[model samples]
Target: MSASTEQPEHLRRSLSNRHLQLIALGGAIGTGLFMGSGKTISLAGPSILLVYLIIGVMLFFVMRAMGELLLSNLQYKSFIDFSTDLLGPWAGFFCGWTYWFCWIVTAIAEVIAIAAYVQFWLPHLAPWIPALLCVLLLLSLNLATVKMFGELEFWFALIKIVAIVALVVVGFALVAWGFHSPAGNKATLANLWNDGGLFPHGLSGFFAGFQIAVFAFVGIELVGTTAAETADPRRNLPKAINSIPVRIIIFYVLALAAIMAVTPWRLVEADKSPFVELFVLAGVPAAASLINFVVLTSATSSANSGMFSTSRMLYGLADEDHAPKPFARLSKAAVPSLGLLFSCFCLLLGAALIYLVPNLLTAFTLVTTLSAVLFMFVWSLILCAYMAYRRKRPQQHADSTYKMPGGVFMCWVCLAFFAFVLVLLCLQADTRAALLASPVWFVLLGIGYALKSRRAGKPDQAGS
Candidate 1:
């Protein structure tokens, strides 16, 4: 593509290598690792280790394919950008909008999490006050400039990274000294096997863990979204992607292993955060609230990320003429002002609904369920889009220095892996409900695409 054909970028390329690196960690180490790990351990026992490994390996391929694709065309902003040309305009429209919706649902969940978490500090405070305030503060930070967004994410991610490193260090000390947990379980490597062996729930339980583990990786593909606004996509993006193995090791694998070693997997609770549980263990004064503060910041961090990415996605959609024209317009600060405000409004509305709902728990579950289903669609789009890039641009592939490791073979493997996740989705009731309702979003997108194409006096284009 020539410069004449290149898409215009109004958003500033202000994010640096440090910003990108920490942003990757920020997105990866959110509520999923902090809160959801408890449930995963409860279901899969020590086998959750394998579950994280499998999902991380599969997603690494997905990111490898994405890194190659994004670097293949600097003109492309997000995965959806090239999907429009390589796949079809509809591919861009469907996946781009679906991604926006995914973040919206995720942001809502995080907002509710913030509200509930703040209650741990003030027992009688209204949920809506802190939730609305959190959204407004995050929105103001995002609206300032891309750099402000970067700064906010940097500090938030720093907290998470520091917390994880502390957890690993503290946990290892606990295990090395032979510290016994409050429940009388000894902190040792043997705890992994001493409690009914690794596969306590057998193969069935192992597969069941994927249902939750998959969503734990929802934002792992985030760097690909920063292609246009990143200072040096070639160097910084790959550095962030290359560190995935180490990240999985330290953040997910070792952290969980440390937790299980300190407190046996059998003693872990499904309903509570293992971090808080362990911090509040014997001889730790006020550690529970400290961990709770970390959890609150983690939730706020996730929502902050959702706000930043969702606005950019909307801007991409509008720049491509897939969305309203105003969304493409940028502020004097070179930010997508319209898109950012719109996303923030939707977040506030969603938060308000959650606050007013008769059953806040039910609302939170519904939002999470939808987020998982749509994130699956968005990730699959990345794989399918990579496949299309490979088939359609052979010369480009041959010229590229950073290519997917297995090439086309791994693309098929990743798709098959996703198909297997869908099967697991159906095996559970919450995920099953989400799988069934998954059609509603796609159907709406299909209708919207058809109408837009009709108005354009062109036939609807479909992706292979």
Candidate 2:
């Protein structure tokens, strides 16, 4: 590689506290909460609230560990950087590539989702058009500058925040007024337990809820990735991470509680959005259209996040010689242009697949399931890295102002929780297939790592 190609330009620190906070907020709230929560409700009943609370609490620890590690060393770009330093190069290779692939798969799914959501309005339009256009739009915004990507996500996240807040507020009002639905069921807090109690589906149903609910929290660690571009992460990152619990209570718990209070758990359609269902029950004008637009932007926001994260992950990998050097090269805007384009190109192929595949929804389910499984792996690695940091850098942990609560003990707890979720995946045929198919990715990574290591050795041999 030439010196010019190895220019030391790095990710800019343009994202302010608001961007970090919203990005963190956006990561916490995913499309699954919008489109997939009904299935969770049907599977777990009112116990679904408990399921989300557990996941949120567990993931908050994961984020805290991640935040502490990142702040411990400002030179670290992401968790991948810390993982590589604390664990080994192999850890970095596997975590980096797997994370990159995870987002690629997620971005593709989001693209497909965007197309399907568009079809709700433009029934006659081809699915690929909107999917392709969505990718192009995100690519353009991300390529412009880091702040532009931040701004795009800021508004995208704002829309979701507004929509969710509206749902909760309206839902509470209906319950207060003792509003009755068209089905003659009164909207009240009793709806949460009136049917068959919170665990109406039993422990098995509660366990089943973990399978889908885990996916809702897939992007929760995304704030860690933005550490490089975030301005004053020391002050801002903690603020974002510490507020996670409150956000979860408001966004997931309160919002879902409101939904059930208005509609009842048994009444939520497993295949449809409870958010839209709640609005329809509330007699909102054009509720379907309104919720449809919110979900569309939600999907878009998720894809935008995937694009930004993947490029940065690739850039980080390239900086460590885990990927091609060109990926590390930045545009005039300090954006990882090549990696962004590469990820978008993969997304475009997903658009093409949407045109070709007859059963894209089924395929999408498998893809998302696989993504959820892999994300757990990444989260596990974060905890593992945290444990390693605790053992290897006790001084840093001791001196740090923002040490992870529960410390290494929480790491074990979080890891065990992920393992439990993985076991639950086996109970369902779809998730079981995804769980079983996950090894193929690792097998491929092992082979790639060995080859890269051997090739690295050859140059050293010649020089000696």
TM-score, per-candidate, Cα-based: 0.95, 0.96
In angstroms, the error of model 2 at 388 is 0.6
Candidate 2 on 391-420: residue-level lDDT in tens? 999999999999899998999999999999
Predicted candidate 1 versus true structure: per-residue lDDT over 193-282, tens digit per residue:
898899999999999999889888888888878778899788999999989888988999999998998889988999888887777663
Worst 10 residues of 2 by lDDT: 1-10
**Which residue pairs in model 1 clash with each other?**
none
Question: lDDT of candidate 2 vs native?
Answer: 0.91
TM-score of 1: 0.95
- In model 1, the worst 10-residue window by lDDT is 1-10
